[model samples]
Target chain A: MSTDALTLDRLARMQTAVVLGYDPKFPAARRERFEDLGLLPDTTVQRLHTAPLGDPIAFSIRETVLCLRREDARRIFVKSVLP
Target chain B: MSAASLIAEEEKLATVALVGSPNCGKTTLFNAMTGMNQKVGNYPGVTVEEKDGLLVRGGRKARILDLPGLYGFSAMSPDEAIAREIIEGKSAFERRPDAVLFILDGSALHRSLGLLATVLQEGLPTAVALTMVDEITARGGRLDTLKLSRALGVPVFGVVGHKGTGVAEVLDAAVDAQSWPRPVVAAPLESAVARAAWSDTVLQECYREPKKENRLSRRIDEFVLHPVMGPVIFLLVMGFLFQAIFTWAGPLMDLMSGACSGFGAWIESWAPAGLPRDLVVHGVVEGVGGVLVFLPQIMILFFLINLLEAVGYMARAAFLADRLMGFVGLQGRSFVALLSCHACAVPGIMATRSIPSESDRLKTMLVAPFMVCSARLPVYTLLIAAFVPERAFWGPLGIQGLILFGLYLFGAVTAFTASWVLSKTLVKGSLLPFYMELPPYRWPTFRNVFLSMWHRAKIFVSRAGRVILPASMLLWVLLAFPRAQADPGVPAAVAQSRQLQQSFAGRIGRFVEPVFAPAGFDWRINIGVIASLAAREVVISTLAQIYGVESEDETGLVDMLKKARDPETGRPLMDFPTAMALIAFFVFALQCISTLAIMRRETETWKWPAFAFGYMGVMAWIAAVAAYQILSRLSV
Candidate 1:
């Protein structure tokens, strides 16, 4: 598969940087709050687990389990060990 | 693990404590279980409060305690301390729950599961209530509910608490399920290496991520959190909320005022002539009516706040304000509590319970009185009507409402500065770091919205009955007594009323007039100030009583206020500048008894409230004096 087409599960295990900022899908309010809570781009986060329905994805950053809408997750770039 | 030893001793009707991170729909589930059966109050020593309720789930009725939301249960913060104590049955929180409803957002299972995993090792009989199922589904994620349930060795139920979807089913299953056969409890991690080793394995078995485009939230957060535009958006949103409140509540305010005045007039005809009629019309009706008029304003504010909180915008506001608020040595959460003081300070001070830090809580309670409360409305209205020209600024901004808004802004600024000064001078401390969980945005339930509004209205009316009525009656006695003796040289009407000028109130104000001379306040204004200490709304009623008006609700208050003549110049009493001075005085003054009472109770110290009143009183007088001097000089 192309690098851009990498599976989310693979992306979860890898750590990379995403160029863009807040995702477009969820409300602006949530993203702003996440940023205030120090969950911003280029910050290293371990992608933990997604719920069965998978809207709010959990990531472990600075030992805090920060939950973000999936749309927010895609905007976030994670470097991959496999890549 | 002896889990069986711990469980076989569990009592039926055992308490179930629902604990989780904030914004996890925990409150919604609590409400679903308990209905109108929750009590809100402060916890011991610390202000971050507790909410308690009883739930009848399954075949047995168990006490359900809703603990303050914690990011984790590691016993670090006061909130976490309470959660841990309850779980360990070490705290006086009515003993440990028989089981725990370890509720988490189904949308963020892994992060939530991190906490859940900790709870599982606690060896407590626990079940998971997976909420926000629909929101998760919409995001193209799915949960293996049965598989996860089996792996965790506990029952898990899917619930949408707001919609009442699958709530009863989940609740029934949760309360009915007994302790499972005792299983091995994980050993406590010995070191950093051990913890790292354990958490990795826990994540592997139960967690998954969805494969999709994370495009939506990213785009929105970009514009909203933009350094330049974010604060602007916040202000515009707040401005719109205020404008909507004023426009929406205007008609209701007018209707209520009219009905009150009509009722007062009708009662006047039935009351005996002289003191009885004056007391009924001027003291009771006008005093009470003044407070009632602000009902719509209070209601509108409450509704808007509840809506904001429900829709989850409140958390976002806190996020935006966090940095600015830290400068004043307060958590961003304290802003909402202090803002609510504009409606009434009592509840505002009570709301300080939500601020986890004791120093932040005390400081918030102390400065809350400085916020111009709804009680100050009557004073502002009377003065504005008497003197302010109704001309609009730039043809759109109401000069009157703008003035009112300016006073509100002044109060807010003063409150922040005062807190900063207090933190530096007396309550010395570095600002505490804040951690808050921002919940997902959701539609507000109409039930919660209406219920909150109703609660506020009830508090308003009850206060009117308990405090306002007695205070107005006392003012009535002071105004009405000491019947004039006949003087041969004077006409009967003149002779009968001369005693009022000689009576205690008259003598008192005259004695104090020199003190307020610099502030441009005459004896009448001084007397009005004295009467307002009982309740600020009583000032207008007292003024109407002193003016010898029998019916003061509508015609009496307005006419007498217009007729008031300045003792210094013998001109119309309330000139534009003097009216401006009066508004400024009330804007800064700590006049409300209710506010002081709440402050004293919250702080558990009479010294704080007394000191607050002294400082604000001095500030008010100086500000008013300076304003008057400037206006008088410019006029000359």
Candidate 2:
């Protein structure tokens, strides 16, 4: 409910964001995978592009571009950082 | 099952593993390390395959295993699970690897290095084969391999896996498993948070990424991933892929078919002319050769698909198809598989290995056969040529062409529908997160491509020779026996017909005729259906035989088919409804034995194949009856 509680899915294309931790309601197993993938707090992720059909957004996280579905991406909260 | 023969008895060769995240060039490294000296087999109790190769240096041999790609230590998929258990020495299925040669992709260092935390935690003697360092340098990135080695407490050697650069040093160090040093400090296992922090610390010390991300992939993606242009390009690429399979593989397939038949005839010339010769020539050789002819198309398909995969286009293709495939309850990769089925389902089914999810792969496997393959071409051509009128519907599209296109469309729609129904009924909801790594574009090395093509062709040929040959022989027996009791003076064609009508296969055909009666199939058509199991084209020859026409004389056969009548009804043997029904059935039926054989091998079980056969048989019957009824009613 805080003003800074923006999720990864809302981040603009090519805009970098600082990880603000995963949503508490996110399933534990999947959330754990996000952590393993270097989504730790303060890690910077940049939204690169959306797939042709507008999902599985490609994001540069920890120097690798991962194509993630919007459903999972939306569950990870982040604060958009200006270029 | 292993490279055991390369070592002496009672002397166990040291084992080394090439481990990395997917698309990190681990397989490239495997080939670089052990070229033309590898074996591939399924890991016990899993459909995932195991590949290990022999490495010998100065009289010392080490077996190198190429573990499946993984992202992190916490196993998310079956591939990761298999790799995880083997590394931790917990696998009852495989001996613990003596050392781990971590394949580090310099271009994706942060995550790739972070994955190293898990590998380091294993505490197995470790060395890193730093790959794609040139990619980093080309992009103006700097990497000090010596500093990286010192930071990680393991030897690090930069290597271009495709070019076989620096492979000798890595293999030299890895070959002596006991001498390789373990990590100075085992990584924290409590959480990825701790590991990520530690890995970042290591990166901070020695890694400098290209300030600018690789721009080539970005520039290409701008057009390839454009909403309109991207899809158009995807279609053009897919259209080209299918066209290659259908048109290009034709001459090669014809050549193979010619060789098989010529060899069969040559052998027949040497052997005595009798029932045995007939069985050997017509039953075993022709039956087996029919399936062998598919090798050209299958191998060509395998090569192109692997090329797309290795060059990273397949990931882009997968991304483009995600939403569409998701609509049909499949991963984006399933689109390629289903499309490949349009050429042949065997390779289509084989291509499902790229689908990360197990159930999605199985569902895709189940759905693949419904797509019209080249095998069905002969039957469709025969039916259309024999019954369907040849009037032009439009430019470049005749009634015959429209009918063929309609059959293709029907197959495609049915494939998607079958997948949807399966999603709801059998596989249920796909709960796995639909995530994939859209890797940066890279040119495929000819070494990797050729090895891939050769490996697949070998597997297909050997497996086909083993499984399909015997099954075809059984079908031959059904069409070849019971001694028709015709005098030797009779004509060959009449003798052949009588012989076929009394053969066990014919008896079964007659027995099964009533079951298909409602679908407008007679005993002769039933015989064609039963014989088509060898391959869909076999129906043409089978039908040609029973109709008392020469096997190769298709024109004569079509004429006879059109003029022939049912003795009971005094009507044409194949009316419009009957032809329509047969075409409908062929579109839906799982008639090819090779498809089922590969399904059995890929799934590692007969249960799924049996299920496929049962469901497709039922659907084919229903579709046939519906087609027959609709057309007959309209005509009347």
Winner by TM-score:
2
Question: What tens-digit string does per-residue lDDT give for candidate 1 at B1-636?
Answer: 122112324544556788776767787888788666555444644444566655565456555677777644432556667787877778874567677888976755545665665566677777888888777666666666666666667777788877989788756755554563223446664332343345446545654444542334434544554456656776776776656555666688789889989998898868777766877787888768756765776677777777878876665566666556767877666877787677667667766655667778888887888788767877888777766667788668978778878878888898999999988888765222334444556777777777656656665556334555565567656655665565788654444345556666667878988888877877777777876876787777666555545554765676777786654578765566666777778877888765665565556567888888898898889988988878877852
Q: Per-residue lDDT for B451 in model 1? A: 64
**Error in Å for residue A28 of model 1:** 33
DockQ for candidate 2, please give it: 0.64
lDDT of 2 by residue, B1-636 (tens): 565434522477788888998888888888876789887767765888888888777777788889999888663678788889899999877778889999888877777877888788788899898889888888888888888888989889999877778878877776687688978675465677777678778878787777777789889988898878888999999999999998999899889989989989898889998878888788778877966887888889988999999888999898888888888888789999999888889888988988889889999999899888888987898889988888888887899989888888988888888888889888986445667777888988878888888887777777656778888888888888777896889889878888889999999999998899999999998998999998888787787788777648778777877887765678777888998899889888899889888888888888999999999999899999999989989963
Among the numbered candidates, top lDDT falls to 2
Candidate 1, B3: how far from true, in Å?
34
TM-score of chain B of each: 0.78, 0.96
Q: Candidate 2: what is its chain A TM-score?
A: 0.90
**lDDT (CA) per prediction:** 0.65, 0.84
Instruction: Give the lowest summed-lDDT range of ten residues in model 1 chain B.
Output: B1-10
* Real A-B contacts recovered, model 1: 0.00
